[model samples]
Target chain A: MVRFIDGDTRVLVQGITGTQGSFHTRLMLDYGSRVVAGVTPGRGGMVVEGVPVFDTVAGAQDRHEIDASILFIPARFVLDPALEAIDAGLDPVVVITEGVPVRDTMEIVANARLRGTTIIGPNCPGIIKPGEVKMGIMPEQVFRRGNVGIVSRSGTLFYEIASHISRRGLGQSICVGLGGDPVVGLDFIDVLRWFEADDETEAVALIGEIGGDAEERAAGFIAGGGFTKPVAAYIAGRTAVPGKSMGHAGAIVQGDAGTAIGKIEALRDAGVAVGDLPGDVAEALGGLLKG
Target chain B: MKLLEHQAKKIFLDYGIRIPRGELVDSAIKAREVANGLGAVAIKAQLPVGGRGKAGGIQFADSSDDAEMVARGLLGTEIRGVEVKRLLVEEKLDFSDELYLGVVVDRRSRSYMVLASREGGVDIEEVASTTPERIVRHAVDPVFGLRDYHCRRVAGLLGYSGKEMFSLASVIERLYRVAWEMDAELTEINPLALTPEGFVALDARLNIDDNALFRHPDIVEALRLGGSSDLSPREREARDLGLTYVELDGDIGIVGNGAGLTMATLDTVALHGGRPANFLDLGGGASAEMIEAGVSFVMGDSRVKAVFVNILGGITRCDDIARGLVMARSRMGTEKPLVVRLVGTNEEEGRRLLESQGIPTLETMEEAADRVVSFMGGV
Candidate 1:
C-alpha cells in the first residue's frame, strides 16, 4: 500500500546515456523498480546497463508501457524533456535535476497542471518504496520495509532521519522528497492526502526546514482534520538568520515568516510531535507510533 | 539578484512605464550638473537593499548647490553596510496622492500575484501588518497573463474610477509585463504617485531571478552584476567555486552534502555550544574534486578554529568524499583540525581512505559536531 509508487509501477529513465542517469537507472533496476524504457534525444539505439534507450518519450511509450518518468538531465536542458514526458502522459514525473531556473519550472508546473500531471521536484531526490521499488537516488540500505510514510523537503536530512528510524526498528511504507526550492509542484498536503488513504501507512514523519509556509499549511490541514494519521516532524534551521538562504534556495527566513520556530509551533498545535534535532525526529515518530 | 533603484527604473522605462525625469550620477559634480537641468530634484542613493529612505539615503534638493551637498554626503557612505557609489537625481514631482503596486511570485498559488494598495508612500510590509485590508491582490496566471479585468479590479479597489481607473490599469499592465519579461521575483513601486499628468513611479524595485538570468542576456550584459558586493571575499570565492556558502560569526566552519542537512548541522553545532563559522553545502551529487575544493576553502578561513564535514552519502558517494578528504589533507595539510562523518553509499571505502590519511571520522552528525566543539577545547 505504498502511497505514490510500488514494484509494479513501470519507470521511464530520461537522460539514460548520461553518467548519473545511467548509474542511478541501474541502481533503481537493481532495487526492483521495473525500469522498462529509457529516453535521450538522438540516442535511440543506445543500450544503457541493459535498458533500451529511445529517441523520445513517445518512441519509448510506443514500445513499452511507462507509468512514471525519472529525469536525470542537467538543469539547462531539463525543461524540454520534462514537458515532453508530461505531454506523453507520464504521471508523477520526477525531475532529479538541481538548479533548474524558477521560470522554466513555472512553465513546467503550469503545463503539468493543465495536463493533470504530478511533477515531484526540480531539485529533489525522487520517491522510494522500501523493499519494493526505489524510484529515487536515496541509498537503499537506510530504509526498511514497514508502515511509516515519510515525506521531506530536504534529501540528506530525510536520509539522516530515515536511518535513525531504521535503527529504532521502525520501517517505512514510502518516502517522498518534495524538493527544496521556492516553488515546487507537489506540496505537503498533496502527499498527506495519499498517506491518509494508504492503509499500510500507520504513521508519517515530515521533514521540513525554514522557508516557505508548506509546513504551516500542512499543519493547518492536519488541524482542520484533513489527515488523521499519527504524524511527527523535524523543522531545521532553528537559529538561521533572517534573509539568508541556508543551502537550499527555499530555506530562507523572510521578515517574520518561514522560521523554524513558527513551523514547530504550528505542527505542535496541530497535535503533531515536532523534534529539535535529526535524531529527535526518529524518537518523536517512535513515540507517536507507540501511542 | 536584486537590481538597484537606477537599474529598476531603467527596466521600467524600457517597458514604457512612466518614471521621473532622472539621471544616475557618480560624483557630486555630476549630480549638480543633472540637478541644474531639472530644478527641485530628489537625490536617492542607488542600493540593492531597502530601508534607505529612512536611513537618510534619500534627500530632497531645492537648488543645485543642495543637490551637490546631498550627493557629496551620500556618495562613498555606507547605508546598511553597503557603500553607496552612485546617486539618482530626479525631478521631484508634486503629486496629489500616492498608491502602491507590486508583483511577486506567490508560493501558495504557484503564480505571480499583483498587489495594489491605496495607501502608499510608506512601507508596504508595515501597512500589510497594520491595516491588512488596505492591500488588494490579484493572482495572474502565467498562461492568460495579467488581463485588463484584473488590473481594473485592483484599480477599483484602490478607489480609482472611470478614466483614472483605465489610466492606472495601463501602468499595472506595463509593470506586470516588465516582471514577466525580466523573469523578476519581485517588481515594486512603493509610491505610484498620481500626478496632474498621470501616475509616475517615484521609486522602483525589480529583483530578477538569478537562475533565470541566462535567458535574459541583455540584462546580464547591461547589469554586469558581477556577483553581489554584499558577499564577503571568502563567500564570493566560494560562489565562484560553485559551492553554496553563507558566512557566520563563529569559529567552527561547517560543510555538508545538502542544504537542509547543512542547516541542521549548523543548528546541531550551535546546540552543542559551538559557533559555526560558515555554512557550506557541497550540493547533492558532489564530486571528489568539489569536496576537496570546499574542504580547502573552509579550512582557508583564518578565523575558523575547527572544521566539520558531515556527508550522509546517498547520491553523493562516500568514497568520493573520502578521496576528496585524502586529497585535501595531502594538499592543504591539517592546519584546521577537521572532523569527518561519512555514511551510506560505499561508506567503507570512504571511511578507509579518510582514516588511512590520519583524519579521524565520526558516524553521526551529533558525534561530528560534538568532536569539533571539543577540538575548540570545550568552547
Candidate 2:
C-alpha cells in the first residue's frame, strides 16, 4: 500500500467550491483518486466536478468515511478547515494553500498530533503516487509508477528531479513535497520513516535545500539505522549569501547553522550519496541502486 | 519583517510594558537635544539586524555633548553592512537584575516556546551552549495560549518570588500577547531589567511574520513606508512587481521559479565559475507580467553582467516564461546575455518560442550554468 494515499483512498475536498479546489479536485478524480465529497460553507447541496458539496467536513464525513482531505482554501481560513478535518478523523490531511501564518500552523500541528492525524504541507505540492492517485498540484506527466521514493521541500524542484528520474528510466513509488514555509507538516525524517516501512519503495531520493536543520536531522536518523534503504540526496543553495531569505521563509542562511555545506557534510557522513547538483542526483541514485 | 528597536519598543508600550523613554533622531544635533532632556542616554543605531552593540552601533553618554559626539561617530556610518541613518536616543536605566526572556516558534516541538534565563546581557545562543541549565524553556499550547500559570512557572524557574514574581510573570504574559497579536516569529526582551520601581523591558526585538502581514494592515503599511526608504532601487522595483529578490555581492543575475530552485540556480551558476549578483524567485504559477518584471528588475542591477533564467515548470508553464522573456527583450531593449533553462510542461513549445527569437535555450541546469559562465568570461 502507498504511505499516505493510494487507489482506495476516499477523499473529501475542503474549500472545494473555490477555483484551485475545484480545478485540483477534477485532476485528482481524473487520476483515479476516490473523491467522495466536497466542503464549502455556503456551497452545500451543489455538485462540483461530479462530487457532492457539503457545508462542512462534518457534513461530508456524515455520509462517507473520508480517508483524507485536501485543503485549497485561502491562507487565513485554512486553519479552521484543517482543525475540522483533524477532529473528523481524516488520516492524512493535505493543505495546498500557501502563506499560512506560523501561529495558525502551530495550532493545527498541535491539535492534529494530539489526535494522531498526519498533516502534509500548508504550502506545498501535495503527494503523488503515479498511475494511482494524484492529490496535489504537481503536473502528472513527469512521474512514472515505479520503485523510487522521492521526498522534497520544493514544488518546482520536486517536479524537476522527478522528470530527471523519469527520463533516466527510473520511476517513483510516491513523491511528497513537505512545503517551503519555516514550519510545515511531515518533515524529511517523517517521510523517510514512512518510505522505510513501505515495501514498494526500493530507494529514496531526498531533495533538500539550504534551510533549517531538517536535512541534518534526517541525516542523523539515517545514520542511526532508522532507514535501511539506499538513499540519494541533493541540497540546493550552496552559494546563497548569509542573512538573506531566498524566497522561502525557511530557506535563509542564518550564520552557518543552516548552510548547504553543513547539510551536505551531515548527509555524506551518514553514508548517503550527495549530488553536487540536482542534475547529478539521478545518476548518483542509479549508481547506488546498481551497487 | 524585523522591526527596528524603537518600533519594537513602541509595540511594547502598547501592551502596557514599560520601556525606557526614547526619541528617534535622524541627525546628531537632534540626538543631542533628546539626550539633553533625558540627562543620561544611550545612542543606539536603528537597524533591523542584531549585534549592533558588539558592532559599536550602540553608545552610552553621560551628557548632551557626549551624546552628540557619539551620534556624530555613528550617523551615516556603515555598521554590519547597514548604514546608520537613524539613532534612537534613550534614557539609561538603573537596574538591580537583568533577566532574559523570549518567545519563539520551536521548530523541534512544532510549538511556541518561551525561553527564560536568569543570566542576561549576553548572547542567548552562547549561554545555551555553555550553560544549558541556566536557560529554562516552557512550550505553550497554541490553542490554550500563554496562561498565567505558565508564566508563573517560568517566573519560578527564573527564581523570582512574591511581587517581583507576579511582575515578571505579567510582563512575560504581555510580551506573549504582543508576540501573538503581532504575529511575531520572535519576540525578545533581552535584559528585562528589574529596577526598584518594577520590571521594564530595556531592550526589545520583534520579528513579525511576513505571511501573516495580511491580518495586520497597520504593520504592512508601516513596513511599506520603511521599505521605500530602506530598499535599494532594484529591490524597490522587484517589490512593486511582487517578485522575491535579494541583492548579493556577485556579477551574474539569477532568476528561477520557486525558492529552492532559485537558490539552486545560484549555486549552479557559482559552481560553473560565475558569481550570482542577486537571487530572484519568480514564484509559483508566475504570470507573463511577473516574469517581465523579474527580467527587467535583474537587468536594472548595474552589478549584473550576465543573467540566467532557470524555470522548472510545474504549475508555472514554460511558454509563459518564454513569452515574457521575448516581450522583456523587445520592450526594455536590453542586450545583456541571458542563458535560459526551461523544462517540464510545454517545454518544447517554450524552447521553440525562444529559439525563433534567436535566444538560445539549454535543456539542463548544468548546460545552462556552463553557457552562462562562459558568457561571463568563465569567472
Candidate 3:
C-alpha cells in the first residue's frame, strides 16, 4: 500500500447525506476507493449512491470493516462525529469541514493523541494517493502515479505544486494537505518521517505558509538527519506579514520564528532546497532528486 | 478578535483578577469626571494594537484638568495607523515590582503555556531575545487546566514567597480560567504590578479565538456593541463578503482561490518585479458571482494598474473563474488590464472561454506574473 492508504482500503464517510459529502463520496468510489459505509445521524436508514448510511460510527462499523473515516459534518456539529470515529478506532480521521472552533480542534487533537490515531484536518482538503485512493476533495485528472511525496499546509498550493511536477512528467506517490488551521494532526515532521520510510517516494515537495514554527521545527528535524530523502520546499507569504488581527501574542509566542524569511533560512540551513515560487518547486524537486 | 484594554479589564473584573479602577470614555468630559473621582489617572488610548505606551498613547495626569487635556490630545489621534476614539481612564497604581504574566497557546506542546518573568513593562520579544532565561514557562494540560501546583511553581519562579506566593498563584489560576472559559488565544498582564495592596493587572491584553466566537454569545454581543473600529471601509466590506482582502501599497491587484495560493500569487507578482495592491483570496470552490465581487472590489481601487487572477482549481472550476473574469471586466467598467492563470480542473475549457472573450489566459504563474508586471509600466 502507499504510505497512508490504497485502493482496497475500506472507507467510512461521516455526514454522507449532505450535498458536499455525497458528492465527494461518489467521487472517491468512482476513483476506486472502497467507501463501504456512511454515517448520518438521523438519515441512517437511507442509501446514498448505493452506499448504506448508518446513524453512528459504531453502527457503520458493525456492518462493514472501516479503515479510515472522512468528516463532512457542519462546523458546529463536527466534533462529536470526529471523536466518535477516533473512539471507534479509525486510524486516520480526515476532517474536511471548515470553521471548527480552535477549542474543539484542541480537544480533538488531544483525544487523537491519546488514542494514538491520526486526525488530518479541521479545515483542510484531505489526502490522496493519485490514481489509487482519492480520499479527498482534490480533482483526480492532474495527478498521476510517480515517486514524489507531497505535503502542504494549503489546499491550492498542494494542487499547484503537484500539477507542476506532474506536468514536468513526474508524479506524486502521496500528497497530503495538512489543513489550513492553527494546530493540525500531522506537521511537516510527521509527513517527512512517513516519506522517508516510504519506498515509493523518491523525493519530497513541501509547501508552507506564514504563521507557525512548524517549518522551523521541520527544518530542525531534517538537519538532525531525521528524514534522509531529498526535500524541495516553498514557503508562501514571503511578502506576507503576520495578520494584524492575530495580535502581539502570535509574535511574542514566536519570537524570531514563523516568518517566511526565517523559515526559508532555516530550511536552507538544513540543506533543503527552497523554491522562490510555486512553479519553482517541481523544477527544484527534480534537481534535488537527480543530484 | 482582540479586546480593547477596557473590555479586557471589565472581563478581568468579572473574573476574580485584580485590575486598576477604570472606565472607558469617548469624550473628554467623561474622562475629567472619572479623573476627578480617581484623583491621579492614566489616560490610555484604547487601540487594538500594542506598543501604545512607547508611542505616547498612554498619558499620565495628576489632576482632572490634565486628564481632560490628555484625553483631548489622545482621542482621534492615530497610533500605529489606528485612530483611537476611546480611552481607559484608570487610577495609577504605586507598585514595587512589575512582573510579566501571560497565557498563550503553544503549538509545540500542543497545549496552553503560562509565561512568567520578573521583567515587564517592555517588549516581551526583546526580553525573550536578550534574556530568555528570565522567562519561566509552564505548560498547562488542557483537560486538567492550570493546576494549583503549576501556578505555585510559576509564582515561586517569579520570586514570590509564602502568602504572596499563594496569592500570586490564585491570580494565575483566575487568569487561566479567563483564558479557558473565554476561548482566548492570548491573555497577558504585562507589568502585573505587585503593589502594597496586591497583584493588579496594570495592562490587560486579551485575544479571543475567532473560530470559537460561536460559543461565546456574550463576546459576540460585546463585539456587536463595539463595532470593528480597526477595519477600513473596504476591509469591513471584504469581511462581510467572505473574502480575505489585505490592502498593500502596490499597483497590481491579486485575486486567487485559496489563502496559500493567494499569498504565493502576491510573492510571485513581487518576484517578477510587480507590486501587489492587495491580497484577495476568493477561497476554495468560489463561484462566478464571488469572483466577480472580488475582482470588482480590487478594481475599485484607483491605485491598481492591473489585476492578476490566480486559480489553481482542485475544487474551483476554471470556467467559473473565466466567467467571473468577464463579468468583473464588464461590471466594473474599468480599463485596467487583466491576467488570468488557470490550472487543475477544467483548465483548457476555461482558457478557451477566456481566449474567445479576448482575455489572454496563461498556463503558468511565472508567465502570468511576467505579463502582469509588464502592464504596470503602461496600461
Candidate 4:
C-alpha cells in the first residue's frame, strides 16, 4: 500500500557484479530490502554479496518472485538491460545509470508504457522508504520513517532536503528521485498521483529544477484538485544560465518557458507553498501541513 | 552536440536527401573558386549556434569576385561567439515555397516526434508560440517503423498533395531514420525549399546527444577537432576529465554533487551577493580523483577569487570529497579561501577529515554562502 515499494517487495539487481551495481546492492540489502537475485549476463554463476546471479531477468525470475528490478549498468548498455527486464515482466523498473541516450531512453520509456510498467529514473537517485526498503543509491542515514512523501528531479538536492527534514524531526515516508534526464520514468505528476492515494504519506515535497515543462504540468495537475496532500515545492536553478544545460539533460531554459519563477508562480496559484531556498523547504512544508 | 551546417548537409546527402551543392572552405580564394564553379553562390558562416542570418553571417553573391569579397569580410569575424574560420559556399536555389520539417525528442510524450510546418524560413519557436496549429506533430512509434499513413498525415497537414506529398513524406521518413540512426536530439531542415525540380533542403541542423557519442565515432572525432570550440579552455579541460563544467561570469568558484544541488548552490551564492565563477557537478559516487579534478578546474579560472565546495552526499560520500579537496590543494597549490559544506553520508567523518587539515567546514548551505560572500568582501 505504500507507494511503489514496501518491506515485502522482492528486488532484482541488474548489472549486479558491476562496480556501482554491487556496491549499492549491499546498501539496499542493509536497509532491509528483500533483494532476491542479481543479473549479470556472463557472470551467471557468480554470487555477489550472497545474492544469486543469473544471466538475465528471465533466468532470475525462474528461482525468485521479483516485484521490481534496479538497473546499474553503464549508460551505453542501459537500454538492453532495461528492455530485458521489461520483457521479463518487471513491473516497476529503476534505471540508475546516468548519461543514457535520449533516443534509447525514448524507446525504453515507450516500450515500458506500452507494457504497463513503471520506470523510475535513467539518471537519478532511486527510491527509499525508511524502515522498509531502499532501492537506488540514496544515502540511507538521512531517511527516517515518517509521513512526508518526497519526489525530486535532482539526487543530491533531494538528500539535502531529506537531511534537513530528518534533522528537524520531519521524516519522509518515501523519497523518489525521478531523475535529472529529460525523459525520466516517473515525473512529478505520476509520483504525486501515487502519493495522493497512499494514506501513509501525509504531505509531499517536490524539488524541481529549471528546464522542462514537467513542473508546469504538475502545477496544472495540482490546480485540477487531484492531489489533496499539502504540497511544498522548491524549483532550483533560478540563476541558471539560459539556453545552457546545467549538467542535467532536463535542466535547461528553452526561451522563456521553463524558468524557475514561472514554475514557482504556477505552483503558488495551485495553493502549493514554494520555498525560496533548499533550506526553507522543511519550514515551508511544516507551515503548509499546519495550516 | 549541434553540428555545423556543412556536417548536417553531409548527413542529409548521405540519406539521399537533396541539398544545395556546397563546398566548405576556410580561405577566401578557395571560396571564390568554389562559388565560380557553382555559378551564383551563398556564403554561410559555419557555426553551431543560431541567428547567423540576422547576425550578418550569411550573404549572397552574384559573381565569384563578390563571393570572395564577402567571404573575406566574414572569415576573421566572430558570429554568435564562434570564430568564422570556415564558410560554406553553396549554389543558390530558386524555390517557390518554404516549409519546415524536423524530428525532435518529445519529452512529454516520451517518444520521437516528427513536426512539419507550412510556414518556414522563420523562427519555429515563434510559430509554436503564435500559431501552434500551423505545426503538425506525429509521434512515431519506435516499435513499428514510421508508417506511410503517419507521413501522409503530416504531408497533408503541410498542404502537399499527389507527387509532392509523396516526396515530402519520403523526406520526413528519411529525416526520422537519420535522427534515429544518428541518435539526434533534434534533426531539422528548416525551410525545406520547394524548388521547381523538387523539395531541396536549404538549411539543415542536427543536434546529436553528447551521451550517445560512443555510437558515433565521426562526431567524437569532430568534437575533438573543434566541436567544443564554443567551450572555454577551462570548460574544455573539465570535459577531458569527464566532468560537467560551465564557465559563468562570477567570482566564487562553486562545485557540488548533483545538477540541482550545483545550480542551487549557484543561486545561493547569487542570493548572498556573490557571483559564481563556474558551474561544476562532480556527479554521484565521485572519487577523490574526480573531486581533485573538479576543484582544480574551478580554481584554475582567473576570475574565481574564492572556492565553495557544497556536498550533499547521497551515493556521493563527503569524506571522499574531503580527501579530494585536500588532494586538489596539494596538486594545484591554491591560496584562495576554501569554504566547504558537507552533509549526509559520512558527513561527520568528512568534516573531521577537513578540520584535521585546518580547513573549516560549514553546517548549512546558507552559512557557507554567507561566509564565502563575506570572505570575498561582497560583490
Can you write out model 4's per-residue Cα lDDT over A1-291, one digit (the tens) per residue? Answer: 223888888999999998888998898989899999999998998999999999988988888898999999989999999999889888689898889999889889889877888998989888889888988888888789888999999988888888888887889998898999888878889988899988889999999999889989999999998788898888899888788889998898988879998999999999888888887888987776677
Record all residue pairs in model 4 with backbone atoms less than 3 Å apart, i.e. clashing.
Answer: none
Error of 1 at A60 (Å): 2.0
Tens-digit per-residue lDDT, B61-168, candidate 3: 999999999999999889899888889999998999998989887777667789989998888888988899999999876756678999999999888999889989
lDDT against true structure, model 1: 0.89
Cα lDDT tens digits for candidate 2, A1-291: 223988999999998898888988988899889999999999999999999999988888788878899999999888889999999998799988878999899889888878888888978999999999978999999899988999998888888788889999999999999988888878999998899889999999999988789999999999999989999988988888787777887787876668999999999999999988886888887888777
What does the interface RMSD come to for each candidate?
A: 1.1, 1.2, 3.0, 1.0
Stretches of candidate 4 above 4 Å error?
A1-3, B226-228, B332-334
> For candidate 1, lDDT tens digit of each residue in A86-126?
89998889998877877778878888888889889878888
Point out where model 2 deviates above 4 Å. A1-3, B25-37, B64-86, B224-231
Give the best candidate by DockQ: 4
- Write one digit per residue (lDDT tens) for candidate 3, span A28-144: 999999999999998888999899999999999888999999988888898799999989998788998777776777778888888888888767889999888877898888788
Instruction: List the DockQ of the predictions in order.
Output: 0.77, 0.75, 0.55, 0.82
Candidate 1 lDDT over residue span B1-379, tens digit each: 7778888888898888899998999999999999999999999998767789989999999999999999998999999988888889999999998998999888888888899998889989889999989999998777677899889888998889998999999999999998888888889998999999999999999888877888878777766652334567787888889889999899998989899899999999989989999999998778899999999888888889888999998889899999888888778877779898889889998888878878878889998888899989656
- Which stretch of 10 consecutive residues in model 4 chain A shows the poorest summed lDDT? A1-10
TM-score for chain A as predicted in candidate 3: 0.94
CAPRI rating of model 1 = medium
For model 1, chain A alone compared with the true chain A gives a TM-score of 0.97
What are the per-candidate TM-scores when only chain A is compared? 0.97, 0.97, 0.94, 0.97
What's the candidate order when arranged by decreasing DockQ?
4, 1, 2, 3
